[model samples]
Every structure is written in structure tokens, then in C-alpha cells.
Target: MYIAKINIMTKPEILDPQGKAVELGLKNLGISQAQEVRIGKHISLQIDAQNEQDAKEMVENACKNLLANLIMETYQYTLTKL
Candidate 1:
């Protein structure tokens, strides 16, 4: 078995209003130097794969086909043997 850890985030060029809101909220709470806050999603899944490379490929395909939006979001993942 293999475990896949995936992270999905908005593209740098895209605006993240939710992140900005959180930053502003922090500043209001007297948190100085809160430059930026970019939010993202972390997903973990177990795959019945033969090797690390195969697990990575399956996770990448999942991100491309369903998890991450190709136009606005980017994704990366790491595969660990279990």
C-alpha cells in the first residue's frame, strides 16, 4: 500500500479573497507583519499501488481529473510506501 499526500492551491495570478480577509482579520487583532495568507487544501489517501511511482501517477491523475481545477488551481503530491 501507498499513501498520497496532496496539496491544492490557487494559482498565484488568481485572487484569493478569503485569504486576504483572514489577513485583514489578523491585522485587526493586532497581528502586525501579517503580510499574506494563502489558503489551500490538504488531502490524504491510501492507494493499493505496487510502487511509489505508480502511486504518484494515480494521485496526479486524481488531482487533474477531479481534485484541483486546472484553470485556477495548482497541485502537488508526495507518495510514501506503507
Candidate 2:
């Protein structure tokens, strides 16, 4: 079995309104040190595969085809064998 951990984030050039809102909220709560609070999604799933390479390919395809928007967002993942 393999476990996939994926992180999806908006492209650096894209504006993150949600992140900005969080940043503002934090500052209002007296957290002035927080800056550029970029929000992202983290996904974890388990896959049954013959090997690491197959699992990796499946995860990559999922990220490219469904999990992330190529134009505005980017994603990266890590796989661990169990």
C-alpha cells in the first residue's frame, strides 16, 4: 500500500483573497508578524499499487486532471510505502 500526501496552492502570481482575509483577521487579533498568509489544501489518500512508481503516476495524474487548476494553481505530492 502507498499513501499520498498532496498539497495544492494557488500560483504565486495569483491573488489569494481567502489568504488575504485570513491575514487581516490574524492582524486584527494582534498577530502583526503574520504576512503573506497563503492558503492551500492538503489531501491524503491511500492507494493499492504494485510499486511506488505506479502509485506515484496515479497520484500525479489525479493532481493534474482533477485536484489542481493548471492555469491558476499548482500542486506537489509525496508518497510513502506502507
Candidate 3:
């Protein structure tokens, strides 16, 4: 069996209001060490595949089709044998 871990995030050029809010909140809480905080999505899945190539293909397809919005977001994944 194989497992896939996907991370989806908005492009840097795009504005993230939620992230900004969190950053402001942290500053108010006296956390000055905090830098830019970008919010993103993480997804994990298990797939029945024969090899790493097949598993990677499945993950790519899923990310392209549903897991991420290609227009505004980018996605990366890691596949591991389980």
C-alpha cells in the first residue's frame, strides 16, 4: 500500500486575509518573532497501487482535479510505501 501527503496553498502573489488576521493576532499576543503566516491545506490518503509511479500519478490527478484550485493554488505531494 502507498500513502500520499498533499499540501495545497495559495500563490504568494495572492492575498490571504486569514493569514494576515492570524499574524496580527499573534503580534497582539506579544509574539513578535512570528513572521509571515500563510494558511494552507494538508491532505493525506492511502491508495492501492503497484508502484511509486502509479501512486504519484494518482496523487497528481487528484490534486489537479479536485484537491486544489490550479488557478489560484499550487499543490505538492509526497508518496511513501506503507
How does each model score on lDDT? Answer: 0.90, 0.95, 0.94
Candidate 2 C-alpha lDDT tens digits along 1-82: 9999999999999999999999999999999899989999999999999999999999999999999999999998899998
Q: Which candidate should be chosen as best, given lDDT against the real structure? A: 2
Cα TM-score of candidate 3: 0.95
Candidate 1: lDDT over CA atoms? 0.90
Q: Candidate 2: where is the Cα deviation over 4 Å?
A: none
RMSD of each: 1.0, 0.6, 0.7
Q: Please tell me which model should have the higher lDDT, number 1 or number 2.
A: 2
lDDT of 2: 0.95
| Range of the 10 consecutive residues with the lowest summed lDDT in candidate 3 | 31-40
Backbone collisions counted per model? 0, 0, 0
Error of 3 at 44 (Å): 0.6
Which whole-number lDDT from 0 to 100 does residue 13 have in model 1?
89
Instruction: Give residue 30's error in model 2 in angstroms.
Output: 0.7
Writing each residue's lDDT as its tens digit, candidate 3 over 3-81 gives 9999999999999999999999999999978977999999999999999999988999999998999999999888989
TM-score of each: 0.92, 0.96, 0.95
Model 2 lDDT, residue 12, Cα? 91
Pull out the clashing pairs in model 3.
Answer: none
